[model samples]
Target: MKDEIVVITGANSGIGKAAAIKFAAEGYTVIMACRNLELSRETQKEIIAVSNNDQVKLMELDTASFASIRTFCSAFKSQYDKLDILIHNAAYMNHGEKYRLSPDNIELTFATNVFGPYLITTLLLDDLKKSKNPRILHACSNIIKHFFDPKRKIDFDQLQGQKKDSKRHSVYKNYCASKMALLMVTFKMADVYQNDGVKVNALQINGAKMSKATLRKVKPHWRIIARIQNLYFPSPSVMAQHYFDICTSDKFETITGKLIDHKQKMMQQPPSHNPNVITQIKQITGSKVYPAYAANPEIQEKLWELCNSLTNKNMVTPSSEQHA
Candidate 1:
């Protein structure tokens, strides 16, 4: 693992920060892609100071923006010859009254949790492939379970969130939809890149009650149950240990497209593996991704067609960093 090079998104604070610090401590080159430059720099200093690791570096990447990803990837490709690990650790939970759009006019939650990782991963797939043991880990939440009601219909008509009707929906609904989309994509990606030795997986850190500061930021309203859970769950650092295991764990080196539990091998949530659920996810993603890139006839038929038409690029090739 020490021989590997790693990049993490949303490392300015919270879980991302913990992952960066732990990865760096293990001697992996940790690139903290943050939206804020000054904060990222300060974080880099702080991480280095504690870990005493000089291999850690900080790069600015506003995961909410496609342009930022392109620029960051371009510069990263120029500097490093290979990328071993990529953790889609950064995510935005929609808690507001309205749906937010990113610079590219995509829904804020959708753009950050779904498109950001997809665009970056597709763009950098070649670099990830260059590694001897490449792995991509996506940070997802159990909170997504709350949104898994089969009774409700999943919406795929508005892939870009161009419509404003969603403004009426609760922020929690929006957040759940985006996460489910991300997990579905991971299932698709794992199948696509498995043959290439790139193990793509998603995991839940459960609750980090010990992280008083960060926990408050994510869930401000604490009821009795929330408070009780906080007392029993692991701290950010302890939970990060599981994340660290996933990033560099040899146990899952051969396992791809799995929904890991606290960094361990486990079955996915019932809905995650349901054939019907898979069908719905494909419909939502326009079939751009299949269970595997090699298989899933619909993925080749629909998603490929739509993604190229939408992005107006070479669909799934390595993306260059595009900046203003």
Candidate 2:
């Protein structure tokens, strides 16, 4: 019997590493795809020692770079015949950094948090399809609520870094926008790949304890706030267990296009109110409103096309490649 193969991006630390350990312990072939080989090498040792299963492998993958993504896919294809599970766990966020771009000149946050997962899933679709019950889990953030608020709309210019805002927490703003875009993409992908027997779902990450490295990058005042929040946040191990349960349980085998929270409950978008009419609703109910994009398909398609346009011939979509 062949062991199921699982690939987790950004598996060097935090939840990714913890998930790797959990999967390895289950006797699966866990591939730790990450940007930092040095950190990953250390993590590989820990995963092996802790799991007592030596099938953990390390490969370089910089989700922020399109070229790196392509290389990683090619390398993976040469060695592995199938991918049973893919966890898009790698994310890039900065507390107070100025605007940045990937090597492909896309907005860094979108490139990593949204575009990277889209490209990886597209590239690895065939490998995933080879498995009888393949699955793709996107590690999504609940911070998307901020971007999906009634006051906000999808900013096409900002998504590709063509426009910059003078907002104080522009980086955090980018992070939220990217997360919202990711959910849109995840639902779109669930529809696109439905016929191929690929199950795509987004995991809505609640507050999780922050790593020291992540904490160090925060501004001093915010670091204090983060510490206070950390006291209430679930540990990474608890979150990793959730990842394991979702992957291994048959209950999720057919569940697609859903946003699942840490408590294993489905998250539905709040009933959308017109931004203009939000005040009316509030006045009528005297309760706060959670207005969102409704996971609008038209907007999702436009964003999908924009992301596809940014890629070259090698990164064509599955449907397009089919016609070609």
Candidate 3:
């Protein structure tokens, strides 16, 4: 991991912060992409103290806004020559409250969990290509099944948060929607870039400690609700070790376009990984991507266009070339 130039979004705390420290321990030059300056500084100190890796630096990144992502990417390119690994670990889920709006006027949940990481990856594709066995690990969740609907569409317009007049909608459902969009997006990207050596895959990492991000957003009085909500919080650092293993795992150098769960690399089954779903996602995400089991160029194109429109980012395209 020492030689790896790794960048992790929302790296100041929780799973992301833990992953940064672990990577630093393994000798990787880690860029902690975060939104808060003071907090990021504090986290850097803590990480440096624990790992003694001064190579760790904070890069301001707020994935919800394209402007923020552009700044982070440009600043990163100015100093670093290449990116060996990119972990799309930072995610957004505002529980115990109604959905919020991002700076870009999009739903906060969609912006943070889906749009932010998607744009950053597209902007950093060239840098990732510079690595020998470049890997892209997307932080999905086991909670995705929580959002599964037999009537769901890969290109469903409402999945991007146009909900209204529905009191039945819960944070749990919305969070899963965000991750499902991401999962589909990962496949789109993997299809385009897997052959380029920049392998992009998603993982269901459960049992991580509560993220400070989680702390920051929760309403003051909602702590009780939050605790009850998080009945089974896992160790953030331990789960981050799984992230570290994936980012640093030599065994996965050639592995892409697969969903990894708790160290088990398994094939995504029907309906979820169906060609129709991939098609919808590609059209929505603006990437001609496909699943390993069923690669279809036509469907990939349709999904990409839809994705591009929803996010309002020009990075609606991807190339699956496994390289470096």
Candidate 4:
């Protein structure tokens, strides 16, 4: 593990910071990809001091911006040769009802939670492939199952907040939709890269205490309740232990395309698996979000084509073909 490399997004605080510390202590060269340079540097210093691991580093990365993602990826490739683990831990949750847009003009929640991770993973696929056992862990949400309504499906027409009059416009619903979409992609990627030796999985850090910075984003009325609830939650360090186990332990060596709960139990099936629903999601997002067991090759191909066109980056060809 001394030479292993791990990249964690949103590493300035909360779960990402804890995971970085854990990985660094275990002798991995941990890179904290964050949006705030100053905060990330401070956290980097803290991790190095605590773990006594000088290999810990920081890089500026804004998941909400495609340009930033591209820049970060280029810098990473120029500096590093291998990436053993990629943890998609960054997320954004708007407290108000109004919708927000990213620099790329996409809905901010979707841009941060879904599109960013999708693009980053594909962009870094080559580096990940260089590792003997590369793993991609998505920090998904348990709120997806709790909030998902079985009767209602994703409305692709309103995916980009194009229909202002749409009734389902609350921030809570938007967040849930983003998380649901992420889960779908998680399953799809696990299948797509399984043969290539990249393992993909999603997990939720259930019952973990959120950082004060996150709680401050909550509305004042709810913030009090949240603070009280947080008192009973486990520390981020405990949650990091679970993440570290999933990433490195021999117990998960053969596990690939599964949704593991906070307790490390595998969920038999995701919340929703309707082909029509999945297809509609793919059509709108230009990405496939479905379980590996139920994947449609035709749809996946089209989604991939759309992604390459949208990002102006060709990922269909093997990395060796382009880099060799």
Candidate 5:
């Protein structure tokens, strides 16, 4: 484990921080790639104090910004020749908020939750390829079931607010769509790099207690519900153990292109209830729909192309930076 290196996005708090601690305790070199350097430094100290492993370090990275991603990768390449594990754990969900754009002018949620991970992976692919057993883990949500519902279709034209339809601008819905996109990227990359000895997989994350910073951002109306979830759901530490397993456990060493839960069971899709209200609404509205985007090879290919174009369009040349 001492020789292994792992980079976890958003590792300052929540499941990311917990995962960082677990990896540090195991003597792995844990790099906490976080948007907030101040918070991350504090967390770095905490992890070192708790795990007694000074290998835990902090790196600034705002996944929503392409420039930051490029800079982070360049600095990482300068310091480490190889990356053993990469965890796409950072996510942005603005419940009850207006649509926002990222630094690259893409939909903010999709930029951070989808495009950022894809771009970072590409930028660091060579480092991952150098590892004997490189693994990339994507954090996903059950909300993707909305996209999988038979009646709902992922309108390619409407992605990233291209359609500009206010009716389709719901933040929560866009978040779900982004998660679905990420799952598609996971499967596609798994196929693309299977022969290259790089394993790519997604985790179907279950409910976990939200951190105070996250709780503060929750809408007032949803606060009570969020609190209730925190009370009954598993803690971040519990969920982090699952992440650790997928990265280090031999059981997952050979697994790729699959969605696995905390119990280590492979999932085809997130569980959905029998009475699908979303399906009923679409039927009543007579809305034109497409099949599930995750399983559709055509949609997956188009998505891959779209992401490539977006990242390239906003490309920034990476240059080495002195470590802080």
Candidate 6:
């Protein structure tokens, strides 16, 4: 375990920071990939002091930007020969009512929450494969199951939150859509890399207490509600234990392509299992949803193609070949 390497995005604070400390204490070399280098450096110092593990390092990464994702992958590959785990922990939620675009000209929330991880994971496949036990974990939300609209399919055409749809969708709606999309990708990757020994899974840290930094990002009203809710919720450290368990536990060694709840229990498959629903989602957003993607190889290929085209990187072959 002392020689294993782990990379966690958005590790400057919140659960990401907590997870990094947990892994470091266990003797893994933890790399903290974050957008803000200064904050990450401070957090790195804190982790080193607490865990007494100086193997923690920081790397610049902004998941919202395609160029930044590519650049970070290149830098990481150059420095590290093997990656045992990759945690897609960075997420964005806008409090403003208006829609915003990332530097890549995609919806801000979707870019960070979905496409960013999509690109980064695909690009780093080779690095991850070098490890004897490779694992990829996506940080998702339980709200996806609650807020997902069964009636409304993913609008690939309006991924950027067009002005015409502003009346119909709110900021929260966009956030849910992004998370649902990510869940789809999570299932798809789990199947795609199953044979290659890379375990892929998503976990929702439901009802976890938010750090002060995270709370500041919440809307004023939501922050008040969150404060009230935090009284009964577990701390981020407690919630992070679930993450550490899934990554290192022998019980989960064969558990690939499943969404785990906050309690570290496997979530039941979504009610909708229609392949057409997955097809419709892929046709628009370039990804499938839930159980459908878990079984359909054709749909998975289409999603990989779309993601490749969007990022301008053919990191994965269309023929289901795993990169070593």
Report the number of the highest-lDDT candidate. 5
RMSD (Å) of each candidate, 1 decimal: 6.4, 5.0, 7.7, 6.8, 5.0, 6.9
TM-score of each: 0.81, 0.89, 0.80, 0.84, 0.89, 0.85
Who wins the TM-score comparison?
A: 5
Better of 1 and 5 by TM-score: 5
Please give the lDDT score for candidate 1.
0.71
* Candidate 6 per-residue C-alpha lDDT over 89-184 given as tens digits, one digit per residue, 9 for 90 to 100: 999886656777888777788889988999999889998999999999999876564333446444566654465346665667778767777877
Clashing pairs in 4: none
lDDT: which is higher, 2 or 3?
Answer: 2
lDDT of 1 by residue, 20-56 (tens): 8898888889888888888578888999998889988
Stretches off by above 4 angstroms in model 3 are 152-155, 158-170, 211-232, 270-303, 310-324
Record all residue pairs in model 6 with backbone atoms less than 3 Å apart, i.e. clashing. none
- Candidate 4 per-residue C-alpha lDDT over 171-221 given as tens digits, one digit per residue, 9 for 90 to 100: 777787677667767777988898889989888556578788889878998
- Of 3 and 4, the candidate ahead on TM-score is 4
Output the TM-score of candidate 1: 0.81
Clashes of each: 10, 0, 34, 0, 0, 0
What TM value does model 3 have? 0.80
For each candidate, the alpha-carbon lDDT, in order, equals 0.71, 0.81, 0.72, 0.77, 0.84, 0.78
Candidate 3 lDDT at 117 equals 84
Ranked by TM-score, the better of candidates 2 and 5 is: 5
Sort order, lDDT high to low: 5, 2, 6, 4, 3, 1
- Please give the distance, in angstroms, between residue 242's alpha carbon in candidate 2 and its true position after superposition: 1.6
Least well predicted 10-residue stretch by lDDT in candidate 4: 286-295
| Model 1 spans > 4 angstroms off | 165-167, 210-229, 269-324
